[model samples]
Target: MADQTPNSDAYRRGMVTRRSVLGDAHVDRAQANTTSFDAPFQKLITEGAWGTVWSGDQFTKRERSIVTIALLAALGQDEEVAMHVRATVNTGATREDIREALMHVAIYAGVPAANHAIKIAKGVYAEMDQQAAAKDR
Candidate 1:
């Protein structure tokens, strides 16, 4: 096996998975925007959330994506909800699936939360669709 340092494997795996799910552009921008103050925060999420939970095989990425969308929506995390909604392309969660999940968010979390999430999700979907169309040309 190749030589590796402690935490290297997890960090490497996390970075790769994060890129795959979030896309290289988004991850690149995030890394570019990271400052000295928030560097540790970025590293923690990279190794912890992306490495451990996301890399796990218990639930397929699709299921995890749906759950994430719902939870983010419930929490009124508009930005995160939009980001995860974009991730649905890589995770195999469809627009309809997001809508269904938002319905649950409305019932359990509150209608206001779901309403705001829907707005964010719609904008993200529109932007993604535009990108896809541009690529096709």
Candidate 2:
């Protein structure tokens, strides 16, 4: 893997992580929307975020989920935070991770943003739990 160029490895790993984290339907929609204007940006993120960072051995997916949730919340990116909260289930992140990340967000981002993010996280978590419960039955 290290022998390959960053772009190639990144693209490959990004595709894997993108599908695993975002799901095929969401990734398919994003791929369908890709245009010449945004292609480079998409590639960059794929390589940087999925390929290099996510592929690292340092952190487990669960840890990454926590960090990502905290960062997104701190940035006040509610939509992205919500998406990541949804992704957490697949990444081995439990509801506790979301709560802890939100706590961090409150300290770093501000109370208002954290509060809103908490609401969004709770809603996403409720849906996730309901789905899990239904599947078990």
Candidate 3:
């Protein structure tokens, strides 16, 4: 049987961490889209990925960002890769980190996958940078 000891504290911490890393708008949209069909899956990810894994002290958000980017690229998950690219700024992962991870993806995941991921990342990054610049000006 799955252990169901109420991990309220862990869940709270995970929510905070998830919001900080993914941003409030993204998180809110995800929550708004939750349905009977996907609610369980969403809860599972919140508890497992966010609460258990992401809440651990084993890796900084920056390190997690690098790993996530590479995995998404290798899996050909271009949409997820683009989302993470935008989240990188909040995770303290610079554009250099994205570049390095994409370079690794080129060798391991193949040039095609890396090329597509890089293009998506570049577009996301450019939009984010433009938004930041606009705010500053």
Candidate 2: 10-residue stretch with minimal lDDT: 1-10
Report the poorest 10 consecutive residues by lDDT, candidate 1: 1-10
User: lDDT (0-100) at residue 99 of candidate 2?
Assistant: 91
Residue-level error in angstroms, candidate 3, position 102 = 0.8
Off by more than 4 A, model 3? 1-7
Cα lDDT tens digits, model 3, 27-88, are 88888887767767767787778887877899999999999999999999988998888998
Candidate 1 lDDT over 37-85, as tens digits, reads: 7777877888899988898889998998999999999998888998899
Taking the tens digit of each residue's C-alpha lDDT, what string does model 2 give over 10-62? 69888798789878887777778877777878788888898888778899989
Model 1 vs. true fold: TM: 0.89
lDDT: the better of candidates 1 and 3? 1
Question: Which candidate number maximizes TM-score?
Answer: 3
Residue 93 displacement in candidate 2 (angstroms): 0.7
- Residue 67 accuracy (lDDT) in model 2: 93
Candidate closest to the true structure, highest lDDT = 1
lDDT of each: 0.89, 0.84, 0.85
Give the CA lDDT, 0 to 100, for residue 44 in model 3: 78
